[model samples]
Target: MADLTIRNLTITPLELVSVERFQGEKKRTGNVVSNVTGAITGFINATDFSAHHILPKGDSHDSRDVSFHLDPFRTVRTDVRSADPAGREVLRLTFRAGDRRYETDVPSPSRKSSVMKRIDGDDDVDDALDLTVVYVPTGAFLAIFSSAKLYAWMKQLDDAWPLPLLSIPGTHNSPTCHTALPSVRCQSVGVPEQLQNGVRFLDIRVSVNTDNDTLALVHSVFPVSLTSIKYFSDMVDDIYRFLDANPSETVLMSIKREGAGRGTDQHLSRYLKAGFVDKNADRWWTEPRIPTLGQARGRIIIVRRFGLDEEMARSCWDGRGWGIDGQHWPDNCEDGTCEGGHIRVQDFYDVTESQNIEKKIDYSRGQLERSAEREFHVIGPEHDHNPDPALLPIFVNFLSGSNFFNATCWPERIAAKVNPAIVEYLCIRHGEDGKGPNQLKVGAASTGIVVTDWVGANGDWDLIRCIVGWNARLQLP
Candidate 1:
């Protein structure tokens, strides 16, 4: 239980070592103990093994280089912190196993606990492995399940930074987490859990019932949950709780009109105004333009997927009170721009069969590549002084697809194939593993906001971690 385990995801034999440390109580002449890549028996070999590491009793800071014996020996210098920013005792790690090098923050488990046991068993399961997957020339992954990094990942961002330049992790259908048909439910985790796991954007669909003037959370014509119907007001309450607890974070809302609503998008808009905007103006930002992180912290940045009603236009607090104008976005558009070039979207969700998921992945990757090459506009402490400049378009890429007739093309099924491939693509293309031009240029390239589905499924948050890690590029020189 004192040792940290390595779950090697590759077939190669890898060795992890520390190159710097003070003389310790333990004695060692050689690495007689082969934790990972050691032969189990004459006929069998063990893929996952444990390294003899005991957590420091105190929150002391140590610097060490994690070396891998894989081909072309690579050493990663990292600070070994005994605790994270929240003052929670943690075990910071850096090592390599498969075709990737990982830097992780693992919460120090109880003396009677094992890191691998918590990951594979009925323990605290909401903890995210704040893992950065960097592809090396050889070898893939060494897994770790750690702290709730998604709770406050944006605290590191500059207050002046634009939302478009930040690599925000979002869900395709943020609140569709319930017992329903495969096509109706897009997520397994609920709204609050999604935000805890580092998802910042929520894609919501609401239908208005004229009978009682209530809004129902829905996906197409069906309710989000067949057993229990969810209302739009309750979902907003969930956002309130998360943002109140993590004041450093903000939530972007993409609200569209769907389901069997007896009213039009205008009715839906009025219902939102009466329910959230007028009563709790402090928690909502209904501007038609993008705002900096400083302007939106602890607030919901609304991206109006529904049209702005003419009557409500005059009700603006600032004479333009509607949210980010996203009315009439062309369906199934690839690399399309709208609202006078403020937002660019790729929402091609038409993967008819399971085999055609590759096509959707290609389109999604293309959008990421486009966002990477953006002429970015950021406001930080530097030579730049103009607080607000002409806005640059933000890329909102949707890697979500489904076939109405084909059960094989449901959200979860498609995500199983697409998310891993996208994660691999990001690692390979932006590895930071000494591969020239295969990395995101620090403080330059941005992935914008990536809307996905089924995140944190079966203990996998590599995609979220990669997206959040890229924000480090903005922080670094």
Candidate 2:
């Protein structure tokens, strides 16, 4: 398996463009008597088309601007143009692999087309053609798959598994992709990409701009990036699109207040209630209880990290009474039970004084061990007779840490070093010998909601793979 590799995968789409043209003539606006001498004539206006025009004969046209790069595993590009000025003919695709190339005018199964009408005053029209490449493995690589295909494994699990019992992959500072600041930027991908790659948990920090009267996503005071920050409404729409497409999957979003505005928390709370929670209450799990896999499907579980005033609390729309409270959340507490077993946390982000990298890694392992111990108590004789998934506590682990002064302790740096170590430990059996400490036993109860930064960076997915692999024990003989 170490020597397994993908040789080549490429896709190219051809000839699918929409065009629209508009023409108008000038006319006299004054009275008929004043236009008796001579009337001014109107000329044809500019024409609009959905795609770019091909240059005349002997003139080279560059179509590279219309191309798109697909996923990291493969490269794909699409180009389209009319062969004649009359828009009568279209040039097709020529696929190239190795030293051979083949030209074909027939459309493949991957080709698709759609037309979009302009809603504004402009009469322009847009015709879009797309080609989707589905990579089907051949030879020995057929048995291999990436962690992004996690939905296939999740569908096989029992619907009775509580959301807290399963291990989940999460991203920290999930929407800071446009920011180049290493200290503040944590994620390399946007929310949609993260969701597509099996990230079920999101650490979203929001702030209210009182001047603009809009809710925006922010990471502390750093503005996230110089580029335009996404509005909270846009973020919600993106989540809805993903959930609507994949009904079997569920997302746990943790929202908190950032920035120094006076009534920012209250303002955000109101906007969320009026705009989202009130209108789409059915799509969300806003109750103050843990849910099972079957109950949470096609819904977004809210984890509010802000304080609610008395007025806001009285209203059912207040999200503070939702899934979990970040205020009551314990810091670095490894017992896996906080607020009398209502909430559990594994947040250990401070690594400034750590002598070596192994110290942070050991702390994470110890936390998971404690989480396993708590799960065992539920399965033990004390509560075995009356097992309830709702009463079971939730475990939230943070695999992200940083030290601003030392570049070696940045989020990416720590993740690069610690993620592999965690995967290696999870792969070993309880009695086997491995590097460092062996506190955690490899099984179904070993992990829960492991969150981190830069998840698909450098094509390293060992940590997420191990977390998903641990579920195999639940189906054993």
Candidate 3:
């Protein structure tokens, strides 16, 4: 028996039959007991299994009869055993293929296991288990699944559902991953890593470096780091690579201008047009309108947070004319929709005079609730009124905050307080108790993009998981 490399090792409930001996009575269907401890046991050939079995010789021919061993791979049922009761359960699996029975164990999701390994021989086995299986808690499955898998699931939804209707997890100061300065360093991982880890929106702040005639990523007024750092072009190249590898997905990049220089906005705009946007026009969604998933595939939707001068706006590839101009995006507006229901935002980062953390949570929640409220559009004439549920505006919730005093209110600290609450709020809204199927649904009218900092810092992904899991409800039945 060779070590069998396993992939896609998901765990599902099993109903086992129980037998009792009393006064020499044979076991009957009514006497069977069910295991209620949620213990995982055994393996089944999920790919190829049927309920019908061929009738043996001298037996009444009834192909419809359900066979006791319906699964072809169940011949070695006796080999299956209950997992250990210690820290986390483990299920040992054994399956036969061409006179060889390979063996392996499904590791606990709580403990990180080697998802992929190089095997010595047998190309067929290698291909069979190429996709690694992970057993996560029912509600947090989306956190473990790859971004490519999540996009495939999104493709099943109605094409009319615009991007704003979805719950998108984003990063605040996305390209500040390399900064060593504590106050300025926002993310511990770079843009490419964040994108691959299911981040769909990126908060990019760019500045025009007059010295080198180049565009660079800036945090406030200074460069991203005290040392050599990434330029805006570098960030764009990384984005292009990720998009090329995963063509089914789209990215919403909120670009804002920062740093000091005369006509910096125009300079940055011209640089982006000639260097980046012009070359990748087809790869971008430049129209100032919300696009359906089908229309936005393999593209980057620009969300310009800076004003464009006349010259810059007239340029052939001006981003200000792209997707949504979040420039005059109001600060802390509780109204659900802004710009005549075209844009929605929740950026209440001013916590200077706040008395306690509760006030911050309350303010943030209020903003989120406002975004979640339903909006409608008139569909008929004035005499005969018909109001249909309209596609909600793009909701950009800034879950990051800071103040001169108490650096504790920094983006990372604020996320620590708000992320868990957001998860809990979603669980309550979806009526999830963590024991059954997670009915995680953030309808087109609810929570939109959640921008945070230091996500996955200290291994805390509950926020991202909750946001991603919300899309699980859209899966095809």
Judge candidate 3 against the unseen true structure and give its global Cα lDDT, from 0 to 1.
0.53
Using lDDT as the measure, name the better of candidate 1 and candidate 2.
Answer: 1
lDDT of each residue in 1-477, candidate 1, tens digit only = 223333332223344543222221212222655532233421121112233333445443455665545322122223332233232344445444343333333432221112322122334435323333232211222332222366898886788777887888899988888888878878868889889889998899888777565888999999999898898888888889988899999999999988887888778788888878889998988877888888989999888877766788776756664888778675887688876567899898988888788888887877777777654444455625235532777789898998878877888778877877777555445323323233333224577789998886534566787677666555433
By TM-score, the best candidate is 1
Candidate 2 has a TM-score of 0.63
Residue-level lDDT of model 2, residues 1-477, one tens digit each, is 111122111122222222212121122344665443222210110111112222223222333322222332222223332233233322233332222322222111111111112222333323221122211212111011122355434665566677777767787878876655676777767888778767888888877756554666777766677777666678789999988888888888888888554456667667677678789987788776778778888888887776654576775545435445554566654434556465577677777744556777777776566554434223432324236767777777777787778766776667766765565444332112232254434333446777877665533344555566455434333
Question: Where's the lowest-lDDT run of ten residues in candidate 2?
Answer: 41-50
Better of 2 and 3 by lDDT: 2
Per-residue error (Å), model 3, residue 378: 19
Q: What is the TM-score of each candidate against the true structure?
A: 0.71, 0.63, 0.63
Query: TM-score of model 1 relative to the true fold?
Result: 0.71
The whole-model lDDT of each prediction reads 0.65, 0.54, 0.53
Report clashes for each candidate as comma-separated counts. 4, 1, 4
Runs in model 1 deviating more than 4 A are 1-148, 315-321, 376-390, 431-443
- In model 3, the number of clashes is 4
Per-candidate alpha-carbon RMSD to the true structure: 11.8, 17.7, 14.7
